[model samples]
Structures are given as structure tokens and as C-alpha cells.
Target: MSRGARFTERLDLLWLGATVGVGLLGLRLIHMQVVRNQHYSELAERQRTQVIAQAAPRGRVYDRNGDIVATNQPAFSLIFLPGKAQDPARLAGLADSLARELHRDRGELFERLLEAAREETAIHLAENLPLKTMFKLSELKTLYPGVDLIVEARRHYPYGAFAGHLLGYMGKIDRRQWQRLKGKGYRVDSWVGRSGVESRYEDVLRGVDGEIRMEVDAQGRLRRRLDEVPWQVGGNVLLTIDSRIQRAVEEGLRASPSGTGAAVALDPRTGEVLALASTPDFDPNLLLLPEWDSEKQAVASLPEFNRAVQGTYAPGSTFKIIMDAALLQESVVRLDERVFCPGFFQVGNRAFKCWEKKGHKWVDFLASLAHSCDTYYYSMGLRMKGPTIERYEKLFGLGRKTGLDLPGERSGNVFGPEARKARKRGWYDGDTANLSIGQGELLATPIQMALVAATVANKGTLWKPRFVKRLERPGRPPEDILSEPVGRVDLRPEVWDKVQEAMVGVVKGGTGQRVNIPGLVVGGKTGTSQNNLGDDHAWFIAWAARPGEVPSLALAVLIQHGGHGSSAAGPVARKAIEAAFDLASAKGHEAPAEGAM
Candidate 1:
């Protein structure tokens, strides 16, 4: 009887304990499902959800006439989600598969995948893919869980190689740049401007990027998008370049015998750059190709070189214009004064020969400039010496930067008394004679020479070169860029008149006669810069205008190794003038014949 009672009590205690445990478990379930539901739900959601950034379209580039130069095009890119490939085996397999399709090294791809996995972020595997490769990648997506395809905006240039140096190109951001720009909303895969106007205006062109918050399944496949912030497109840049004039300038350069040089055209009244062209230009679109590395050395040779602001050469006899002005201003030489030139001038027993072997027997100020008599200037240079010539050169803005908006503008060399003194070198009359005639250590950019013509045309005003006409932005007013005056040349009215008349005489029948256009009064100076490495560099600086009105156009043309200024550089300048005034296509309008400088 005692044993049966003990067993019944034990059973009763076990039943009571089981009932208490069941009640406690029910309370715990209620707590998790109600009181702290939001907190625990968020924890689980964070494990399966991710935020992916979408690239923003860069700003567009336009010429002065509203022609689009640079814009955006839709491109297919391979996106890798690192969270799905965190496992070592899965990551290695995915990297190997992507490397084959992308033509990338497997070890490099594996390392990149491993780094992204450690950062718990997504990355771009391959971009700007061809449609055929994109389709192959899409098929690979079925086999690879973390792989995806997305459309992105790729930078495109419409004119191909035209104005390529000025328009610039783009490239993917390296790790160093990403570290600096990531706070500014730039992604690791973001493309940035590498040169030209594109690099100069990167801040204005690079708009803010946006992202999409999405939910993913256990396998890392996107299930549904929770929310998204739309990306903002960048501002629009309008250049001061006239596409027609730019085309003419480029055509002239390409047509030259060297096929390697630079040209610049400017509005004489304002410093607006009508056309800025450099030869051996590149098609920026080609750089976006996957095989670009193979052609990199060839591309760097000539195509990427921006010769307009970057190339500096001796001004040659064109510097005679400065000598003419300096001599007249100092009263060292009169407009009617005559000098004898028998082909050569004797300076310290050294003979400097003129371009014309049998030179002008005797020439006055105007005739000296008109005929580009090297002997006449050589004789006068000895009297002027170093100080006076240096003064005029500095006043004319030689050997200095033009402050053009483009990047990498070089300040050409100006070696005179000061420079020679610093280097403990001697200054001689021979040196002065050479400098006086735009030779020997006197170098200038095409832009500087163009400004010289503009200064003469404007009768003494110097305008800062302007490239951008305006900036157009969405949801904002258009910003117009205006011309800014940097300096002015002060001379007597008669001084300007004499200089202008002599220059006019140049086109009327002198070395630069080839630039002559009908019904347009043209003034120019011919130059044959001596290049030790090759043949002389031909140059012509000129300005054109209608009768009884201010000049409108100014130009500077250079032909590397193109022997004579009048014969080589003159024709190119003539072509530019013809295009500017629409005379090349005009009926019965014939350009003047090339003459000797």
C-alpha cells in the first residue's frame, strides 16, 4: 500500500512540472512575437537586405552653337555581390569563371573578389561590355548565384577624334582617387575625366550618385526593391568654340605636309577662342575598349598630345612685329628711316643672312616689316640691345602663360639679360640680334601669337582667352561666362596706324600675301622658326576685318617642319579665314597665291 502511494505521488509531481514548463514556453513565444517584434525583425532583415549604388550620368559638353560634343550612352556592366560569394570555394569558382569571360587574370580577379568580400560590398567585374559578351554573361548568371548584370551610363564623344584634345577622355577611378572622392559620393568603379575640359570641370560634371535598398533571399538573389534614390545628372558645359571654325582649323592642320602642328583662332574684339585644334588627335571612344592596353604606347606617342596650349616654339620672324613696335616707340628708328640690307648683317664678325639672299638694297620701317627683311631687324637689334628688347617682349606677353582654362598650359621660355645673368651666361649683340628677329631662345605658344595679332587688331587691348560660353544646369538658371580683360598695350594712335598699315602691306604683297581674302582687309606677319632637330617651323599670325570697322577674327598657324611661313603656314591661315568668312564656298572668291617670307 505504501509503495503504490509513493509511485502515484511521483507521477503527480512529474505531471505538474510538465504543465509549468509548457506555460513558460508559451509566455516566451508571446514576448518575442509581440513586445520586441520590431527589434528582432530588423535584425533578421539586415542579414538578408543590401543597398546597391547606381552611378549617375555625367554632364554633357556642347560647342558654342549647341552641338553636343560629349554625352552619355547606356552600357552593360557585370556586377559582383560579395556577400553571396563569402565562402572561399564559391569565391574562387566565381572569380575563375569571370576571369575567363573578362579576359582578366584569374589570380587578380580572385584577389579583388576576396577584398570585396572582406568589405562586405559589391563591385564591378567588367564594364562597357560588348552586346555579345553581355549575352554570354547573362547566361553565366544562371550558373553563378552572386553574379548580376546592370546598365550604366558610359561617357561618349560624338565627333570621334575631332577636338579630342580639348574635349578630353574618361577612366575608372583607382583606389587612391576613390579614397579621396568616396566621401563626395564617388564609387570605386566610377569613371572620371582624365584630361582637357573634362578634367578641368570635373566637380561641375560629376553629379551625385544614388542607391537602391533591396531585399534578398537566402541565396543572395534580389527579391524586391524596398526604395530608391534617383541619381542626379550633372550640369551642361557650353564651349566658346565655333564648330565650323574648329572644323576648318582642324582640316588645315590635317592637310599640312607634316600633319603634326597646332592652330588657334580667336575673336579679336573678345578673347573667345573660335577654334583650338591640335593634329594627330585621337578617338577617345577607342580608349574604352578592353584591348586598349595593347595600343597604349602608340596612343601616348602623338594622339594624346595637346599641342595648342602645350606646344611651344620659337616665334621666328613673327617676332619682328614686336621689334617694329619697340623701335618706333623708343624713337630709336623712324617710320621713314631707311636701312641698307645686302642679304646679311655683320655683328661682331658673324654674318646673319636674310631669307632673301639678295636682300632689299635699302628699306624703310614699313617696307622692312612688309618684306620681312631679316637684315633690317638684325642691324636695328644691335642698337636696341638686350634691355629694350626684353621690355617689349614682356609687354607683348611673351614667355608666360596665357592663363587659358585648359590644364597643362606651359609658359614658353623667354631668355634674355635676366635669365642669362642668373645662369652666369654672357649677353651679346648676336644674341640681341637673334632675339630681335624672333629667334634664339625666344619661344612662344600659338595662343600667345594669336593674342599678339588680337592686340594689334584691337589697337592695344588684351583679352583673357575664354573657352566656356555658358553652363546649363537642371533646376537652375544658365550661367554665362564672359570675357575678362587681362592687360592692354598703350601706344600712340599714329604708332598703331603705322603698325596696322605695314601689316596690311604684308598681306597686300608681302611674305604673308597668301592670307589675303577679297573684300576683307587682312594684316599678318610671316615666320620661319629655326628648329635644330628638323626643318624650320612655319608660322603666320594675322587678323582680318571689313572696311571702316573693327577687326573680327584673329589667327595663328604653325606647321612643324613646313619650310616657309608664307608657303606653308600661310595657306592654312588662308583656309581658316576662308572658312570664317564663308569665302571658300563663295563663288568667284579666290585666295591669294603663296609668297616668300
Candidate 2:
């Protein structure tokens, strides 16, 4: 009973243990084959598939009359999928081959390849690939698994360096930008706007990238194309820039004696920026190249600097118009008021000299503006003081950003009581005298001075400056951008008329005589700004209109280190006016004279 019973019990226990083991194995099988089927399948699928991102083409930029400003050109890039070729040795060998073929540094290429592997991302070996190299790589693609040639778009500026500052240029997305923009469809190799309208409208100009999925073999060789998501192109931007006027403005800037300056042209009635030009501008197309070295060249003058809205300088006599407005509005000076000038005006212990050494012996208010009498303005500055001067300067949009639709605009300084206190300096009557004549601590951008002329042309209305006129988007209605009046100088009609008369007198027989045309009613002011750095800067601000018509074009031209406004800047204004009005008799326009303010 003892031995037989014990054997039977042991056999039953063994059977129970075997039954439990079988049930556990069956559950494990069910979990593996059914419960996690989709998950395992995806893991297996990923091992043999590769996704290639297709970059969307950037938007096109057009001028006012539909001329191309910036556009995209077809290009090719070499992409390497590090995930497909996970072996470090394989990646090193691929990098060596790419470096040799693409003429790149071997160490840099290997480092980039390793980084891509560590991040489990694709790396662009060569961008804007040459046609011959692209074809060679295409033929060798099957040999280097996970490597493919992809089509890309490069920005192209049709006008080269013309209006380069306004159009801006493209640059590779840096680490900081990639960190911020990766979630917004930006890849590590994405190109972004660096400045100007490109930067200001980056969101609208950037297109969403699409991806192409491909099935591959275990060796990372492509087997077949699976599917692709088409990319949506970016919207087109139409600027208010008139190509003809822009050309004229650029030519005018180049014509200056120093060949380094800025010019701004505006449509006074609509506040449209017809043309904005800066000399010594670099080609935006050059910046699109793979190895741009402008930053490394140590060039004396920065070609990328946008002087039209960024560079600030004393407005010189061009500021007298603002003073005239203030003077008339406050009854500080009448149209017939007279000021005696003997070449210099005494302010405290300092004697401020006029541009005209001999001076206009006795000049009336209108003649004071036309002749740019510094002594007359000095007398007026004593009465106006710093606060009154600042008020009018701000009213004319000086010492502030003009709100131009461009990046890197500098709000020029207007040093008065507040600014002097901030700088721990005393405000003096000499400072007021200097400021009253557009000198001293006052600073103004070319765009702001252009607005001053625009204000006068549009009859005291300060219209908001506009660059973009329309946006044409895919599957959307064309959007028109309208600029509303931002401010107005509420001066009596007679006051504006008297100011206009003085401006006309300037062009007719005084400082700005060179800007006068045969049949055009042109009003302008000349300025020779004192610069401590070098020679005085020449300036001319003007407004042009046909007889009995509203002023259409208002412009300001500033020539750095140029000797005289009439000689260096006035001719540029005339050329711009000729282009604006299509004046055929411009060849017969008067030659600029030296020594005029």
C-alpha cells in the first residue's frame, strides 16, 4: 500500500505540473501571435523601409508690375539615411566616398555622418550639387545603400545685387533656429530668411515639406517606391516696389561721389515704397551659394547692411522743412518774418556758422528755407528750444522707426533734454541751434526723411509706409495689402501752401535748383550734414508732380561723405524724378553746382 500509493501520487503531481506548463506556453503564443501583432509588424516594417523628405519650393517674390524679384531655381542634393546604414564602419566608408566625390573635408563629412547616426536622422552630404556630380552619384547610388539624390530648390535673385537689402537673402538653419523650428516642419538642412522682407514674412514664405516612403531590402537597397505626400508650395509675395523706379534709385545711389549711400522713394498718396536702394549692396544670389564668405572677407563696408531704413545721420538742412512746419504751426515765425545773418549766429559761448560763409545778409522765412540759412535756423532754434524741436522732429517721424516692412530698422536718436539727462550731459543752446538746422544729436533714417517729404506732398497726412502690395496663395483669393494713414499734421491750408511755396523756391532758384525739370513742379530741400567721422554727408529730399496734379513721388537721397547736397545728392534726385515721371527732357536738366547747401 505504501510504495504503489506513493508512485501513483508522484505520477499525478507530475501530470499537474505538465498541464500548468502547457497552459502557460499556449498563453505566451497567443500574446505573441495576436495581442502584439501590429506592434511587431511595424517594427519589422521599419527595419526594411526608408522615408525621404522632399523639400517644398519657397515662395516667389514679385515687384509692383509683376516683375520677378526673388524666385526659386531647380537644384539637387545628396541625402544619406544613417538609420538605414547603422554600422559605424559602413557610415565611415560612405563618408569617405562622399568626401572624395563631393570635394568636401573628410573629417567634417565623417563627423556629420556620425552625428546623423547618433541622432537617427538623415544627413545632407552635398547641397546644390553640381549636375555632373549629381549624375555621378545617381549612377553610384545602388552601390551606396541608403544614399539617394533628391531635388531641391535654391533662391535666385533676378536683379542680382539690385534692391538686395530689401529682398534679403537665405541662410542655413542654425542649431538655435532648428531647435525652435523643428516642430514647425523645419529640418536641420532647412534654409531660412536672414533679413529684410525675407525674414519679416518667413512664416508666409516657408512651405511645408513632404515625405516619400520606399520599401527596401535587408541590404538597404531600394526595392520599390511605396507612396508619397505632395508638398504644398508657398504663397507668392507681390511688393509695392516699382522695378523702373527701383532701378533709377539704385542708379542714383551709385552716382554719388562716395558711391556709398542710401535712397528711398515713396508714393506720397498711397504710402507705397516704390524704391528703396542702398549702395555697396551684395548680391542676394551670392548668399545662396554653398560657400558664401562675406562674413570672413573682412570687407570695410558691409554689403548686407540696409542703410535705407537702418543707417541714421543728421538730416542737415533737409530738416528745416520740419522746423518750418513747427514754426508756422506755433506762430514762432511768420511767412514774412526776417532774420539777419552775418555768416554766424551766437549761442552762449559758441558761435554756430552757416553753410554760406558770406551769408544772405538779410533773409525772410521763405528765403531762409530756400537758401538753407543756418543763421536764420539758429535764431529760430533759440526760440524753439530742445523740447519744441523734439516735438516737431517726432511729428515728422524723426528719431524713430518709420515702421518700414523691413528688418533691422533703427530708430535714430534725438538727443534733447531727456536724452542729455540720460547720458549725464547738460543740454545747451548750441545743441538746440545745431538741432534746429538738422545737426547736433538728432539722427534720421533715409526712410524717415522720405516720409517728411511725403507728408508735405500729401498735404500733412502721414501715411504708413508699405512694401508688400499683395499675396497670391494657392487655392486662396489674392490678398491686397492696404496702408492707412498713420498720422497727420493739422496745419492750416495757408501754412502748407506757404511751406510748398518755399520748397518750390528752393528748386526754382535756390539750393535744390538742379532737381528742377522743364515741365515738372518739383519742391525740394538740400542738406550738407556735418559728420565728425569724415567729410560732410550730402542730402536732398524732394517731391515731384505734374502741373495741377497731386505729388506722386517723394524721395530722400543721402550720400555719405559727399561734399555738397546740390552737387552730390541733387542730381540723384533729378534722375529718380526723371524715372518716376518718365520725363524725356531729363537730359536737358541743369548740372549740379558745388558749394550750395
Candidate 3:
């Protein structure tokens, strides 16, 4: 009970209490470092750093000869940063100023800023800012704090709308698109390929985005760069399309009566798409602008339809080639057999009229094909009784998608026995006759028709049509895509021989004379198909050089509202064939242009 002993015990108790408190603090520190370290670290980063995505340049699209089809250029955008804005109320005023400067709806831009503010993210007010606008914005920086200006890469189509449909366009990513692409590093504001080749080859064309980490103070003012990650350049896409021949085809279609249609020319042996043209096309450059949607919607014919691969039109008399091929394949008709036509043929109390009001008195099988005699086709069709024409159609790459390497390709519709059953109707002689003449339930795209011409010219070998020839990445070996063969038609060479002879006669002495090019020995068929539409769609399919000559090229043309194939589409096909010959002779054929592809 001594006073000194009591004082020593009290001192020891105080020391022990202090030691326990110190130990507990150390344990809490360890727990934070071990269990909640990442969480705290991320919180710290979110508070002090801003992650800015640096867009990687997209790959360029090139023609066969390395001509530029699509590329990228530096562009500026006026941005609104809600976090950096001095006053949230000032966003409306800033939006109005930007709208006035950029010629946009002031109220809509204001609403967009408010929506972005609620989401706590930056919003782009205007894109593709001109130098003058950038300079003006720079001068007014004092008036608008947090009105950020950023650099971006916007798509540039050097050829404008030359291959617009195939080239496609880029647009702001929506929630649905972002959901699909977010896992692949696509941000909410990312621009994605919405259509065409841009959409089909998005993975190949989209470059890896770089990231910049910026340090900021409590007030959200940028201090300095904390880290940076450089981006990987996108790979290049070299298409089989030839711009020279493509231009010629476009010009030729422009000169046509309808001034709106599609043309596709391919190498019969390789299925390389030499030229694909859809007239009435709008410039892709316009698609990048704010007014693009309205401008495009104003056009009566949607240019984005890409009629070459997407349009489903009645093949018209051009389908006679397939009908005859069926006759030869089924052994139902002989080349020497004769059928009489007196302008019209009667089937089940109904009559199908020929192009000629007073038809030729009598014509053999070859003559039938040469003159596109409707009555002869009507008679031949009535004999088949089943899906003979449909079977022939499948053999010649019709009644289905030609498998062209473009988006939005349609598998053309044709009524076979199965199709008739599906439609709850029985196949009739009249139906057979109508289908035989390419009138009734037959629908085909220009690419399909072109493939048919190519199949015939390839001596029954059907090759899958291809647009892209190779893939090229800078500082890397190019990836070449050789020609792909879909399948070969197993008909006798003599069948094609007879068909070729008749097609040549079509150009030499019949309806397809307009497509006859000197020294080329062209073989072609003209088609004027009827529809409920005001005028029939004119169609022509031709091969340059003669059959048995390993034809260099084959083409198909369609003119919407055009009256006759021979006059409306024939000349365009002829001109496109000529252009192909010229492009072949050019040195660019052997090698790409300098700084190209």
C-alpha cells in the first residue's frame, strides 16, 4: 500500500493503453493496403485524374490500282465539359453561342448540354470546326470557360460519292450499338460504321484508341499529363474495285434515260468486281455534316439502297439466258428445234405478248435466244412443268445472294415449286411461262445478273464475287485475298458454246446491237421487264470479247423506269466494258500508284 508502488502501476496501465491504440491503428492501415487497396486507389484516380481518349486514325480504303476511296483528316470539335464549367447555368448560353456559330438549333444544342451535364460527361457541341471558327473560339476563351476544343479524325471521302454506297458512313454510336461494341473499347461517343463496307469491315478498319491520363486539382483544372498510351494504327483495306472503270460506269448511267440505276462489271474468271456503280448517290461528306439526314431523306430514290447488291428487280428478257440454259441442262429443247411465234402465245385462256407485235414467223432454239422471242420462251416454259427455271437459276447464281462482300446484300426472290407451296399456290403453266420470261415472281440484283453473265463467260465456273482484293497495314506484309470459287456449273461445254453463239448474235443482228463494240466481239442480252410501276426496268448483261476466248470482263446494267434494255442500259454496259479495257491498258493495272494503298 505504498504511495510509490501505486504511482508505478498507474504509469504502466497508461503505457499499455497507448501501445494497444497504436497497434490497432497499424492493423487498420494494413487492412486498407491489403483488402481495399484497389478501391481506394481508383477513388483517388477518379478524383485527381481525367481520362481522355485519343482517337486512333481509321484505315484508308483504296481501289485496285491504289486509288484513294476513303481516308481520314484532322478535324476540330467544340466540346462542352460539365465538370470544368465555371457555372452550370452558363452551359445554356454557351450552347446558344456555339449553335449560332455552327448554324445549329440553339434550343436542341442547349438540351443536349443539359442532358450531358446530368450524366456528368463532356458533350461535343459542334464537329469539323473550320480554322476560322477555331480561331474565333480561341479569341473568346475568356468569355467561355470549360468550352473545350478538341482534335478528332473525321472521315474524308476523296472521291465524294463515287463509291458511297459501298464505302458507307460513320455516325454517333447509340445505346444499342454501344452495348454491342462497348466490350471492344468503344466509348459512348464513339463513331461507328453504320452501313456498307465501313460496317462490314469495322474490325479491320477501327484502330486501337490511345489514352491520356491528366492530373487535375480539386476545382477540375488540368494540371499535367500523368501518363499516356500510344495507339495502334488500323489495318488497310484494298478493294478489287477499279476507280477508273467505276467512274466510267457512273458517268454512263448518269447519261442514261432514268439517270438512276446500278451497274456491276466483273472478271468472269476471277469474280473480281471491276466496277460497281449506283447512280443518284449522295456524297458521303454530307453524311458527316449535321444536315446529312435531312438532305438524304429529301432524295426520292434512297441512294443508300446500293442497288447493285440490294435492289431486287425483275430480270426481264436478260433471264432468257438462264431459261435456255435450263432447256439445255434438262435436254428438253434441241438447238435445231423450231417454235412458231405470231406476236403472242396463248396459255390457259391467257396470252403473253412478245416485244414484236408481229413476231418472226418461225425461230429455232438459238434464234429464240438471239431475238429474245417471248413466245418461244413461253412455249419452252410450259414444257418444264416444274421448277426447271428455278433450278437453272440456282446454277447460274440467281434466286439467292451472290455472296458479294458488301453489307445489305439481298438474296433475290424466285418462285420455285417449294416457293409455290410456301405461298399456298400450285405451280401453273402460266406461272411457268411468266417465270421463264423473267416476269412473274422473279427478282434479282444487278450483282446477281452480273454473276450470271460471269458464270456463262467463265464456261460454267461460278466464282464468288469479291470487292476487297487485299489487306495492307503500314510496315507490314500485305494480305492478299485470291479469287474465291463458289462452284462450277456441270453442264456440257457445248451448252455454253451454243448459248455464247446466240448471245453474240443478239449483239450482231438482234435487240442487243447497241452493246456491240468493234474489235470486242461482244455478246449480250437485252431485257425490258414489266412491273406494276409506271415503266418497266430496263436491263442488259454482256461479256466483252467472245465466248471460248476466255472473256476479259462481263457486265450487267439496270435502269429504273427505263423503257427498253437495248437503248436504256445497253449503251451504259458497252461504255463500262470499254472503260474496263482502257483501265487494263493503264500502267496502274500492273502496280499501285505511288503513296497509294
Candidate 4:
């Protein structure tokens, strides 16, 4: 074949290939533009658009009686979106207009806008807006496109400071917490529960955020609105608290001109906390506010401490309940045993004097308990081993945390060999004498002491203390927070019988007489713990029931620097008991008839 003919054929083939490539490109473009137009448009919009997220409202908190304690109220906030103040030349004029309309300082708003613009963040100019300002913003929304008025959820506690410690408070997540929640929809402005039930149930209370995507021009100005996503609000949380009982107990704790103290009341049978009151409590709303640094510090100081679980102190004579049980349980002491108190117990030349300076000569077991004779307990301690009392302390839920649901619980020192090793001290007989009388290295929290009373009232069963009973999740059955007995006292039923008898005697005629309520059978013990820093800490633990029957409620009351147990803390317990009776009557919790329990 000729060279010219071959070249012509090659040229024709190349032309055909180029034409086919062009046609395929045209078809691909047509398919992308026409068949998948929405897909390509979304891709283009995504390249230009930015998403702004809005926080979802947190869950509400309710009490056991179905009364709302914490909830969200519709609120508005003035936010500075940088895209609205794009032009540097027009920024000051825009800020001046905002200042006049929103009553903010022009210079301050300008600074905020400048910062948000530089950082490219949506900054809150003003929050918790007044109704007048909110209405004005709504009317002038079109005039100030950059100044967005968004409806937000403001946390509201309707009962003021009621159950503040138990309910906890909300605050922005710190740097450390942010690391754990980076992908969990947490942002710089995101708030989390810092303490109490709110902290414990953060996963259940915090809701997912929603966002809206908006297309912006090259100058960072909004061009058009795009895709949007809505938020799913959190579920409601129900606490195991009785509002009436909580108020009454808090009032009782504050009734006295006292400085620091705690009082806890609960159903001994179920370990359901009815009332947990600490005198030094704070209004969570006030603590979470900005520009309230000093106020927050004041509330965060010692006075606001949750003494019910966090305050550890010598339980004083209230600890005698444990001592009595240990001795009776271990068969270390006999009911027929007699001890004579000449105001002091002598151990190797050291004399531990009783609160009563005079002598109660030759008192028996029941009489000794009614009188709170230190000498009798000292004698009992002398018979036991050095670590016996300490071992029993663990059994009685002292020297250990009660496994309470609240945060910052303390496992107070139950002076034993282990504690002695920790403190670098050798065990001694004098320590046992002090331990016998509920003194020296032995320390306990108000909740722990309350558990002691509960154990006795429940006939030696130590139920795990809890604040929440059930979680009321949205569109689901009630989830019961079940808890079993943490421990059980080793004493026999008859031992508890004798111990109950002694406790009854103390309330009826002994140091706890002041806590006795008329027409109710009450069992209690008084404690006056010595304090080197100030006056003695007064304490009282009690339980109330129908005459000659098992108790339904148990309480522990402690007053720091209070003079004497009955004089300072007894009246408080009495008031709470009276309120409990009143609440029972109002709720129609009458005694069961026929064969019912």
C-alpha cells in the first residue's frame, strides 16, 4: 500500500477518537447537571455554606411527688454573628446603631464583634434578655441581619435553693472535660452539670444540638439559606426526694442560730432519701451566673459544703449506737453486766471523764445506755481486742463510704490498725477507750450516722442509700434504680430488741429526751463530740414509729460547735419528725388494715 494512503487512514482514526471523547464528555456533563442536579448543587452549596449550631434544652428535674424542681423557660439572647458586620468601614456605625437599639455600649459591642469576626465564632452579646428588648429585637430583625435574635433555653429553679446540693448546677465544660466530649456535640458554650444528680446523669440530661447551613458570599456575607437540622430534647429526670420533707428538714436545720450543720431523713426500709438538708447550701442559679465570681467563691466556700455527705466529724455519743451493737453482737458484753461511773474511766493513770461530773453509781446495761455513761463503754472497750471496735465500725458502715449517690461522700476514719498505720501511730488501749465513747480518731459523716439509725430501725439491715428512685425516660416505661442491702449487722433479733429498748429509754428519759415528740414512740441517742477548734459538735440520731412498732423513718442531725446534743440538735430532729407525721397524715399513709403490712 502507498505511504499517503496509510497516513490518511491514521488521520481519520485519530479524528474519530477525538470526536468520540468529546461526545462522552458532553454526555457526562449532561448527566451531572440534569440527572443528579440536587447532588451537584448540594456539593457546590456545601463548599460555600457554613453551619451554625444551636444548643438543645436540657432535661427537667422533678421530685418524688411529681413536682417540678428545675425546668426550662423560653428565653432570648442577642448574638453577634461576624458575617453580619463584614465591612470594616461600616462596623462602628453598625455597633452604634446596635447600642442605641439594644442599649449596649457601642465600644463594647464593637470590641465583641471585632473579636468574633477575627475568631470567626458566634459570640453572645447579651443573654437572659428582658421582654421589652426581646420584642424590639423581633420587630427589628430585618434591619440588623448580623445581630441574630435566637430563642434559647434558660435553666430555671422554681423553688429557689431547695435541694440545691442534690440537684447540682450547670456550667460550661472545662478544657479537661472537653477532651472527653469533643465528638459528643460539646462546644465552647456548651454547659454540663458540675455537681449533684445533674453531674451523675449528664448523659441522660444533655440533648443533641441542631444546626442550620447558610450559603455565604466570598466576603463572608450570607447569600442564601440551605439545609437545616432540628434538635431532640432530653428526657425528664425524677428524684427520690419529698419536697415537703426537704423544706421541713432544711427549716429545722436553720431554725437554730447555727453556723454549720447537716440533717438527713430517709425511709429506713427502702433507703430512699426523703430529705437531705445542709445548712450551708447555695442557690445553683446564682452560682452559675457570670460576673458573680465573688458570690460563687462565697457559696463555694466552707458554708456551702454538703455536710450531709461531705462533712466528716467525730460522731460523738451518737456513735454509741454502733458501739452498743458491736458489743451486743460479738457477745463481748452482757445485759446483766454492771459498771459504776464515778464521772471518769481510769486506764493506766489516764482518766476519761464522763460529761456528767457527778457519779451514777452501779448502773446496769440498760441504765448505763439511758445515762450515756462513758465509763460503761470504756469498760466494754477494755474487754475487746484493739481492732475489734474498728472491725465492727466497718460492719456498721462507719470508717467507709455509704455508697451514696451524691458526689463527694467521705469514708471517715474508723480508728483501727489500718488507720493507725496510715496516720503512723501505734494502737493503744486509751484509743480504745476513746473509741468506746465515740471520740478520738473516729470520724463519720451525717449520712453515715443516719445510716446507723436506719440500720437499727430496720432491724440490722443496712440498705444502700440512694437519692434517685426511678428515671422517667421519654416514651419508655419507668426505669427503677434498684439497690440491694449493702450490708447486714451480725447481731441477732433479740440483741436488736435490747438495743432498741435502751435507745427508747434514752429518748424517753435520758440525754435525748428533748427530741421526743408527744404521742409518738421515738428511739434516739445523743452525742456531744469534743472540738479543739471551738465548742463541741452536738449530734442526735433518731427513729419514729407507731407506739411499740418498727420505725418508718430514720434521721441524723449534727450541729457544728453546738453545746449539747439535746439542747442544740434535738429540737431540730423533733421538728423534722413532726413534719413527717404531718406529711404522712396529709398523704393518707394510714396504718394498713386486716392482714396488710
User: Which candidate comes out best when scored by TM-score?
Assistant: 2
Stretches of candidate 4 off by over 4 Å are 1-52, 89-112, 115-123, 130-145, 212-228, 290-304, 421-424, 583-597
lDDT of 4 by residue, 289-325 (tens): 4432456566665454798999888887777788887
Q: TM-score for all predictions?
A: 0.89, 0.91, 0.85, 0.83
> What lDDT does model 3 reach?
0.79
| Model 3, span 341-390: residue lDDT tens | 99899987998887777886799987787778888988888897557677
Flag regions of model 3 displaced more than 4 Å: 1-49, 81-85, 103-123, 214-227, 291-303, 416-418, 473-477, 546-548, 583-597
Segments of candidate 2 deviating more than 4 angstroms: 1-22, 81-87, 111-123, 135-139, 292-303, 418-425, 592-596
lDDT of 2 by residue, 1-597 (tens): 799999999999999999999999999999999999989898777766777788788899999999988988888888876544478787788878877776678888889878866654556777776677788888658766777777877788888877888888788899999999999999988899998878888887888888888887655566788999988888889999988888887887887799999999999999999999998877777666545234324432465777888899889899899889888888888777889999999877888898788878999998898888999999998897788888877777777777777768899998677778889988878788878888888888999999999999988989889999998887789899998888888888987888888999999878888887989999999998888889999999999999999999999999999979999998888888988888763456474553558
Ten contiguous residues with the weakest lDDT in model 3: 588-597
What is the C-alpha lDDT profile of model 1 across 1-597, one tens digit per residue? 699999999999999999999989989999989988998787666557777788889999999888999999999988766444368888888877877877789998899888877765667888888898899889867776657888988888988877888888887788999999889888877889888888888988887888888776655666788999999999999998988888888888898989888999999898999999888878888777654244533565555667788889999989888888888788888777899989999887899988788878899999998889988998888888888888888888887899999888888888688878888999988898888789898889999999999998998988889889998777789999989998988978878888889899888877776677778899999998999998889899999988888999998998888878887787788888878787764333244433345
Q: Compute the lDDT of residue 398 as modeled in candidate 1.
A: 84
lDDT of 1: 0.84
Stretch of 10 with least lDDT, candidate 4: 588-597
lDDT for 534 (candidate 2): 91
RMSD of each: 5.4, 3.0, 6.8, 7.1
All candidates' lDDT scores? 0.84, 0.84, 0.79, 0.79
